[model samples]
Target: MKDIVEQNYSSSQYIVLIFCRLLIGWHLLYEGVVKLMNPNWSAKLYLMDSSGPFKSFFFWLAQDKIILPVVDLLNQWGLVFIGIGLMIGLFARLSAILGATILGLYYLSHPAIIGADYLLPNEGSYLLVNKNLIELASLLVIYLFPTSYKIGIDRLIFKKHE
Candidate 1:
């Protein structure tokens, strides 16, 4: 097996990266848990509110009786798995990628383009960038500059190989 190269990061950098990982993970986990606990919770309203180029696709996802349930289950479990994986530093890179993918879909569904409006009011003004985009970028950063192998559960698990 090819060896993994070690990269040195400053203490502050490590702290910030780890903090971002944990925070995003917690946020995803909370969202998944809330949806799971609420039996009536569905993505219909949100998907129906989509206003971007992919609006039609989102609407279809929310409207299709057969696919809707599958989508809901995947969203719920995907969030839970990705969140836990990130929080625990197990498959952190993969988790970040998946998290970013979900965020990307959300961004596409409700892009902050000119003249675009959403039923959900924006807490802050945005031109072409919003919280989802920002979080996606953060996840990308986490994926590129991974710390899991150094300080997360990955460290313990992968240590044997190293």
Candidate 2:
């Protein structure tokens, strides 16, 4: 009876983990595809012009004159890579970390961009903190649970290395 119960619990855990991975993966993949398809789908205008708390910060960044290009490239490539990684479950942990990091930066850049008002309750900007937090949590779960066992190429690669 104890063994059976333990087995059931383990199976349930895997199911939940896989579900989370799939959900996040699909979401990221969709975002990447959208951005890739839209050449003018730039966040620069929002980050730099939006009347939000981080507007000034983004403005400063834009005018930094040194890191603007690098930041722009990072933003563009980061989204695409993160989306691809999540979708394929390749180096999922690394992808998750990178995604979370990017999200975190966005959150810091404009905590009010989404709807976050805890710190400053106002219809200012979009508060991306929630999104970042959720992504970070999902990343942690992916890192700990490793849902690549079922449908990811990581399995074959890991086996080969072994």
Strongest candidate by TM-score: 1
Write candidate 2's Cα lDDT for 1-162 as tens digits. 223212333667877876777777677667666766777765555466434566677777777767676676677677777767766777776777787787666666555444433432233343344555667678776765675644476556554332
- In order, candidate lDDTs are 0.88, 0.63
What TM-score quantifies how close candidate 2 is to the native fold?
0.69
- In model 1, where is the ten-residue run with the lowest total lDDT? 1-10
| lDDT score, candidate 1, position 19 | 94
Task: Itemize residue pairs with steric clashes in candidate 2.
Answer: 112-125, 112-126, 112-127, 113-125, 113-126, 113-127, 114-126, 114-127, 115-127
What does the lDDT read for residue 78 in candidate 1? 88
State the lDDT at 146 in candidate 1. Answer: 89
